[model samples]
Target: MRIRKKIWNNDAEPIIAIMVVLMVLGTINVFSSSFVLGTTDYENPYHFLRRHVLVMLAGLVLFFAFRKINYRRWRPLQGPLMLAVIGATFLSLVGVLVIGTEVNGAKRWLFGAQPAELAKLVSLMLAASTLSARIKRGKANSLFNVCNMKYGLIVVMAVLIELEPDMGTAAIVLGVPVIMAVVAGMSFKYVLGLGGFLALLILILVNVQPYRMARLKVWFDPWADAQGMGYQTVQSLSTIGSGGFWGMGLGEGVSKYEYLPEAHTDFAFAIFSQEHGYMGAFLVFLLLALLVLFCVRIANRAPDEFGQMLATGIMVLIAGQAIANIMMVGGLLPVVGVPLPFISYGGSSLMVSMVAMGMLLNICDHGRNAGGEFPKGEAKVTKSKDNKVHLKLVK
Candidate 1:
């Protein structure tokens, strides 16, 4: 007990506390929302709950493993790490097309792994590593080249995910890197070109699929086709609306019983809003806000450009997914089927999210010792007498 207390006191308290709270609440809500589905499909009311608990246990192991590692150690091997992530993700994405399990008409999972979920984090890492390396080398002229190369891979990953029909994860995998590049001081002209290109791609993508077009139509007016493409959104909104202020009380929501699709996965927020009510929803948002704040605080205190970029990327990924989930459930945006981070009942997403959180905590710990003053002048890397590149952060 003393040892555990010491560990907690020595780490980032707010992040730890908030993560625990979210996990506990999420576990409870998963049981509440998924019991019916679990029973009907698997003949066990506790199937999802049991699976979620096991997944959460594995996630906890990953969390602690990442927390114990020094964040800077990754800097030395960023290139190889980036390549490995890209290669692994690409294979998984390709493999899914060949032999993957198709869930709800989307081939997204392979051998119990969701590569799209992994893409979000790995792409973020590659973005940070690439941008930071270029910046440290002071390759201002080659900024566009780096952007093209790194973002080109990101685009490929996004395309693969989109082919899986999982546009929500694709958007996040693509969006976070663009945000990081802009913040990393990429050329304005290049950024503009990138933005225009992305807009064109989105336009083309929306038109390529009939269902996507239908989604857009529903986004514009769900009431027009309340029983077709808009069914899920309308159902989700009705669930939230029925919750009132304090909710119908925990374990008492009526929407989860074959009324709302994806009550424990993509639309978990709807179930949460229904059971917890407006106040409960607000508390969930509060927790997410605190999580984002803690990440920003860690980024601000990061020791170098890489740490800052990595931390910021993780922050965007988590907060973006959460916001997208909330908006989709609240009828403020088209249903993109993004899950609420740490709250949704999925092994792959939960594991990936916990890993990101662990990385954030690691950054927080290292940032505490990082000096307050920002490094002035560009960092330079030079080959020493031993032919090894030595990095020097100039003040």
Candidate 2:
């Protein structure tokens, strides 16, 4: 008997649903958190909100555009993409130092784009491609072989970003690739050595910068300098505390009234917590957890080692950035300029995140249709005597 099979199972629907919900929540939170700053800085309460909505719309466009492309196509193009990303990152980072706009004492923007954000995504792609190639060649286990052009370029990118004085982003750029390498089967001893080197490097970086040291000190005791260096942390904790079990109600947050800084960007979660309470905070956590789980599933089902590594890198990027931002806000870590993935009000961050999700969804669709193994008694394909292709279910 003839049978039929669905060409596309839409395994990515859950991820898309979660993404849309996060975007909607983000839109509301951005407006709520930024109106006060918008009014003060631009003399219009809707200034930031309007800009944010435009960016979100553009992000959605890119998301759909990327989703339609084949994930495997990126593998062949990795070389050119790697060079382009490295060049753009180098120029953008240096150009920012020369002609980029300065916000709060750091120059991290050039031509309305944050190259560091784009670098993160591209670097992961390059890492995945390079590592997968190494694994295929039987050289993945060699530390010397693994430390190739791709790894070096990524390190350079991280250094340039750190020079932007954005240590938080630099850390993500540096850390995620190592995680990918480990997943690619790097030896444990090398992993430990690399970890020690990274930890020592972080220590030097933190100790070399007075501001970083201050942030570290503030992390330890915000109340010691509550009115000065530690003001934001103290206010963040207070804002979250005030939310109690249920938030203060949307738009009723008091911290955005100049008590807490960067309310819509790096510390957006605090404002969100202040307005929505513990339940709201938990909801965001749940969504992120779900997103991470979905990413793992996609990685496991990816069509090839390349796709698997790519998916793994994307998962690490989202989870790592979200954890860093939330921890910074909660005083579990020193303040870092990392933004919450979909929830932060930054165009570059949102755009990059959306594009990454798009690629992930593409991987999910590809895996479902082409990669996964078929179960027994499911539909099978055969050719008839007339040379017509037919699908039949095993009895």
Write the residue-wise lDDT of candidate 2 on 1-395 in tens digits: 87768643555877888898898998899999999999999999999899999999999999999899887767634566546656776788778878888888888999898989988987788788888777666566667534878788789888988887898888998889888898878888888888899899999999988988888887899999999889889999999999999999999999999989999998999999999999999999999999999899888766566878899999999999999889988989888889998899999999999999999988876664433553344444445786443456644
Report model 2's TM-score to 2 decimal places.
Answer: 0.89
Expressed as tens digits, the lDDT of each residue in 48-82 for candidate 1 is 99999999999999999988877665553355764
> Which residue pairs in candidate 2 collide?
247-276, 247-277
Specify the highest-lDDT model's number. 2
Worst 10 residues of 2 by lDDT: 370-379
Q: Candidate 1 at 305: error in angstroms?
A: 1.1
**Best candidate (score: TM-score):** 2
Candidate 2: RMSD over Cα atoms?
6.4
